[model samples]
Target: MPKRVDHEDRRRQIAAAVRRIAADRGLEGVSLNEVAAEAGISKGFVQHYFASRDDMLRFAATTLRGGIEERIATPLRVRDLLVALLPLDDAGRDDALVANAFLVRALKDPEIAGHFRTGHGLLRDAVAALIAAAQADGDLAQSVDPAAEAGLLLALVAGLGDAVLLGYQTGDEAIALIDLHLSRIAA
Candidate 1:
């Protein structure tokens, strides 16, 4: 018999290791040796999955984007979005840390820039769609520009994420602040 293999699952676990590294110490600490050790795999195995640092970063950034999309697509009420906007929970905080770390690298790494641009554009479009839905349901102002509103929502989300990472406010307080923003936008 041969060893069982689940390539996609293994890749996901590797990327998750990358995300964890990024969250804890930023990209500067995500070296091949460290990731391999953290993932409990050999360095050669990690290299087999991700040929270089750029590939690993791309996977990590893409994973981060997938997480946000999953949140947006989940069957949650408009009110539920208030909770989603806050990154005060451990899961949210980790995601925010992973995302910002990727953003930091994307600024100077062209190999991974397309991955970031695509992920960010998709997230922006999803937010725009959410705004359009709110308008259609008479839950938000009719005059809202989906693009501009999406930008504002992105800014708010980013700010909240940073605050969460920096420990400026607890989860409940962050949720309350997000609630206030939602209230102003509600029709």
Candidate 2:
């Protein structure tokens, strides 16, 4: 009898290790050796899961996007969805760190850029739909274009996250600014 290994879990763990490294030191020098050490697993074990560093990073990016999608999933209010996107907590901060790390990489890597573009488009679409719904219900001003508003709101959220990460502002202050923006746009 041999120990049954959960392959998907192992892969996810390895990806998480990547995120931790990216969050701590950016993604420049991440390697299988470093990832294996961070994951407390053997280098051979990591290679068993990921064929190459790019493969591991792609999986990690997918995992990061999936986490964001989960946070903004159904049954949530528009404000809740927007709030979920901010770096208001430790997990959110970690996600922000990983996202920012990949953002720089996306500048030079088409595959990574594609991943980010798809995620951003999906998130923008979802937010636009929510804005449209709010407008329909008369909670938000119908005078504003939902798609344009969504794009602006997403940009604001990204900027606020950066501000928080850079110590330019606190998370609570960012949330207050977001709420103020929402109030001004209210119906």
Candidate 3:
């Protein structure tokens, strides 16, 4: 009998290797051999899943977006979702590193930039919906624009994540700042 290959699992393994490389070295001059070594697989194996470096990166970006969407899909409160975006743990830090690395590349690559724009837009829309719900429930002020508030919240969280990554502010301090902002917006 032939061995059954889990294609999705193999793809995710390759993406994880890419994330590790991006986090460690900023994704510049990364080769198939390097990725294969990091993934503990052969270069041919990586090629079997991805025909080119750009394809691999696209897969990694999609995987990253999927992760964020999954977290958002969970039945968590608005505060919990905001907290989850912070680099409060090793996994979050790794994610932040990979995301920042890709962000630079996205500025130059239109395809990559599209992926990021779509992901960010979806996340922002979801947050806006949540804010609208809060306003309906009288938790947030009626005068606040849900779309505008969601955009500011997302930008603030992104800035806070960068601060945490740069060691300028601790994760707890960022979270406290977020809570302070939320309190000011409460109805």
Candidate 4:
């Protein structure tokens, strides 16, 4: 009997392969051949989920952005915001690597770039909203400029992600650094 296929599961598996490929190889080198080999699936099977290399990349980008957005929206106390943004372990590092890969790919592809920009804007907006809410509740400092501070928070998150991904810092160190950064924030 043929092996049963779970279409969504297989699709997610393929997307995971896409992230690994881009993480290991530059995005320009990503192809069905390489992805199939990396994923340990047939080349034709890779095509089953994606029509072309671009489709695969786009799907991967969408998936990564969706995940980050979901995490950002998680109902956490204001104090946990920075902690949620910081990658503090193997799982977090892998997720950051995947996120960085998508952002890097966006640098060269217009379609990917648009998605990246939109995602970035959404994150910044969320940060602003959170900060503003905290300040209104008298939980944040009145002196902080929500918009400017939100941008800074986003930059710090990106820097922390890069440091963790590049081995410049361990996950624990990253989390500690983020805590220090958070101490300076209004809320």
Report the number of the highest-TM-score candidate. Answer: 3
In the range 79-122, model 1's lDDT, one tens digit per residue, is 46546756656777777887788888888888567787786676
What is the alpha-carbon lDDT for the whole of candidate 1?
0.78
Ranking by lDDT: 2, 3, 1, 4
For model 2, how big is the CA root-mean-square deviation?
A: 1.7
Misplaced by over 4 Å in model 1 are 1-4, 75-79
TM-score of every candidate relative to the true structure: 0.85, 0.91, 0.92, 0.79
Candidate 3 positional error at 139, Å:
0.9
Q: What's the lDDT for all of these models?
A: 0.78, 0.89, 0.87, 0.76
lDDT of 4 by residue, 97-171 (tens): 777767777787898888778877887787888888888987778888888888887787778778877778876
Q: What is the C-alpha lDDT profile of model 3 across 78-186, one tens digit per residue?
A: 6778888888888788888888999998998898899899888988888888888888888988988989998999999999999999999998999999999999899
Displacement of residue 102 (Cα, Å) in model 4 is: 2.5
- Write one digit per residue (lDDT tens) for candidate 2, span 1-187: 9999899999999998999999888897589999999999999999998999989998888777866876788634567788899888888888898999998888988888998999999998989999989988989998989889999999999999899989999978988999999999999
How far off is residue 29 in model 2, in Å? 4.6
Q: Per model, how many backbone clashes are there?
A: 0, 0, 0, 0
Model 1 RMSD in angstroms:
2.2
Q: Which ten residues in a row have the lowest lDDT in candidate 2?
A: 69-78
Best by lDDT: 2
